[model samples]
Target: MKPFLCAAILSVLPFTASAAPSSSEVVESFIQAYNQHDVGLMVSHTTDNVTWMHVTGKKVKVETSTKAEFGAAMTDYFESLKGANATILDIMESGSYVSTVERVTWDNDGEQLSQCSIGTFRVTEGKLAEFWYFPAHACDELSLKPEVAPEVGVLQQTQY
Candidate 1:
């Protein structure tokens, strides 16, 4: 009977592990929902007390303190941006944290802004518990341009 019980538990373990989405997967799916402008779907991927923070230079401000606030803020943002879009340029996942470099574009009337930004999210139990957005770096900024040496022509950046 002991041997049979152990085998039964072992057989069900894989299915249990597969039941919940990984932390990174949840973050990525939430971003997809954002692109679709589905505020409800976005909130569904976050915890009840989910928090969103914006990092501006030396200051960090809480943009949204709860899931309800997040949904309301997103609704307002979608209306203001009209057709804003975010493209994930790169992403990395470690443990419960997921970080992404994204290109965001939006048009405000006749003015358009395109910027690259870094966002980090902490997910718990397959739901985003909190997220932070770094200050935007314009996509066309000199730092993003390829580096070059005047004498060597093309220069390879060295890693420290």
Candidate 2:
């Protein structure tokens, strides 16, 4: 009888989805691992079939597809650029997606070089599932430039 009563109470109680890492948390952790140059730790934060891409003007490039591939590519990159680093300049969170502007810098021939890119990441089930990167630009150059205002009488003189 007690077992039956307990079961009835449990059935009436509300239940929620298991506690999963938030989209921002997953993306942030991945970047943190990348800054540490820990490929294994970075892979641990991604799905087995993770994907990475770069979306340029009218073109898309697949950078990595599988976890093993990602690890290998990162390993090779880290070897060539030992002290390169990435910093998140801005970020936005929406549902299962996290978008961030990343500032990456490295030294070349005693000169420091930096670039910025926009990346949108999708996290599923507490893991980074996929991501896309916009074209990179020099850090000092804004990806979007300010538009100049049209002349006061230019539009008025023009016909449709």
Candidate 3:
């Protein structure tokens, strides 16, 4: 009788579904496209009236007047990369918001500069509507690896 009770309880145990993809996935997709230098997919994830801002509070209003114009702008940015690749090291998600630490590798006058950066994205209805990005800085010599590779960096508290 005890064995039968144990079996019944075990059978009744709930099975949890796999964790759904966080908004970070959207960011990751963008990162991959940026790395691969694919602009089409990068802009497709963004809504038409996307607002991309930087840490300094500078804003770009991407009201392309038409979807085609929007796509062209994205393509132009990608083409301008000239082999620049971005790597996403850490990502954390809360509700519709996803934050990630990234490293961007680009060249200037034959010198290679790898800058560490952090970006947060606000997602709505499966689209990334807006985002805020802190400027990238030179990495410390002691910490060779970017924070996002194995673990996520802790972010300061801010309004969502």
**Candidate 1 local Cα displacement, residue 110, angstroms:** 5.7
The weakest ten consecutive residues by lDDT in model 3 span: 59-68
Candidate 3 lDDT by residue in tens digits, 1-160? 9999998877766533444456877778767876776667777778877677666547544335444565676677656655587877678899899998777787767888787878888887777788777766775522545556544686677987
lDDT of 1 by residue, 29-138 (tens): 99899889999999999999999999998999999999999999999999888778888887889999999988888887788878898999999988999999998887
After superposing candidate 3, which stretches have Cα over 4 Å from the reference?
1-20, 57-73, 141-160
In model 1, the worst 10-residue window by lDDT is 140-149
Candidate 3 CA-lDDT value: 0.72
State the RMSD for candidate 3: 9.7
Please identify which of the two predictions, 1 or 2, would achieve the higher lDDT against the true structure: 2
TM-score of each: 0.76, 0.76, 0.63
lDDT of every model, 2 decimals? 0.89, 0.90, 0.72
How accurate locally is residue 107 in candidate 3, as Cα lDDT from 0 to 100?
75
Sliding window of 10 residues with minimal summed lDDT for model 2: 12-21
Error of 3 at 58 (Å): 10
Residues 29-146 of candidate 2: C-alpha lDDT, one tens digit per residue: 9999999999999999989999999999999899999999999999999999867899998889999999999999988878888899999999999998899999998888855457
